[model samples]
Target: SQQGEEDPQALSIQEGENATMNCSYKTSINNLQWYRQNSGRGLVHLILIRSNEREKHSGRLRVTLDTSKKSSSLLITASRAADTASYFCATDGLNNNAGNMLTFGGGTRLMVKP
Candidate 1:
């Protein structure tokens, strides 16, 4: 079963602004991964935060994970037109073979205006 669900089916923002996306899951997860996909393209791994970590940063992206709340958020600072894409949150359950099993959320469509 899919464990994560992203809030705000869509988002629109101006360039240079910040975009934040949230995801909530139903099960305990070992780690959460965020991905970005351009229109009709494959997903690109953005960042991954383990259950033991609260926050992680990669370039212009910041991710936070709260195991207690079963939620995660992704923040993209200084948004650009190129940042327009669909963002997805994936979670790996706490099972022994969970590493190979990733459940993905529906995703949030972000439109960054130039």
Candidate 2:
């Protein structure tokens, strides 16, 4: 079963604006990873935040995880047309029974208008 699910299935923003997306998951996780996929392309690794970590950042991307609420949010600052893509959240179960397996969410499609 899928562990993570992203909200606001779609988002639209203008270039230079900030875009935010949220994800919620069930069960405990070892780590959560965010990924970006352009239309007709492979998924690009974004950032990963461990269960002990509350927040993480990489370049223009900011991610916050709240295990208490079983939710996480990703913020993209200074958005550009190139930032337009589908964002997904993947989580690895704490049990580790599946080894390195990860469950992915449906993802949110973002459109950045120039």
Candidate 3:
């Protein structure tokens, strides 16, 4: 069953602002991943944080995970117009099989004005 849930259904920001998004899940997860999609097109993988890790960063993206709370958050620093897109958080169960199943959240629409 899908367990990921994203917050702030929608967000609007300026060219150089910071944007924060949140996600919550309902079950144990091996890892949580964040992705960005522009105009309903292909999704761009942003960052992935393992359940054992507290926080991770990649360039302008920051991700934090709290297994106890079954939640995660993604932060975008110095946002740009290109950052305008739909954001989603996905979680993979703790199954150690070669085939992994990913459950994605509803998604958050972000609009960054130029």
Candidate 4:
């Protein structure tokens, strides 16, 4: 399957804590990206790490990729109420006919407590 799947569909954490989510896929990809969607807003790109890369960091966000295992993970440090949102992992499939397009996973809903 080309779809990515995430674990722990939901997570709750106190403010200032950290939250982590895992994703797995069943196909070869050129890259993987992490995105965040606020309550009613569209998805916002968080980070994109190529298949050759094993780890990447952006501000308070950290992403790790294990291509051999077809899995990736996202970690958000210093959680806040504003950080409450749905997180999704998208993969860039390797296709000759189709250019790069993001394929999103189910997603993980994060809730930050005050």
Instruction: Give the whole-model CA lDDT for all candidates, comma-separated.
Output: 0.93, 0.95, 0.91, 0.91
Tens-place lDDT per residue, model 2, 1-114, is 668999889999999999999999998998999999999999999999999999999999999999999999999999999999999999988877757688999999999999
TM for candidate 4 is 0.94
All candidates: CA RMSD (Å): 1.2, 0.9, 1.7, 1.3
What TM-score quantifies how close candidate 1 is to the native fold? 0.95
lDDT of 1 by residue, 29-96 (tens): 88999999999999999998999999999999999999999999999999999999999999988873
Lowest summed lDDT across 10 adjacent residues in model 3 is found at: 93-102
Count of clashes, each model: 0, 0, 0, 0
The full ranking of all candidates by TM-score, starting with the best, is 2, 1, 4, 3
Structure candidate 4, residue pairs in collision: none
* Per-residue alpha-carbon lDDT of candidate 4 for residues 5-113, written as tens digits (9 for 90 to 100): 8877999999999999999987889999999999889999999999999999999999999998999999999988999999999988886258687788989999999
**TM-scores for every predicted model:** 0.95, 0.96, 0.93, 0.94
* lDDT score for candidate 3 against the true structure: 0.91
Candidate 2 has which clashing residue pairs, if any?
A: none
Displacement of the residue 103 alpha carbon in candidate 4, Å = 0.9
Colliding residue pairs in candidate 1: none
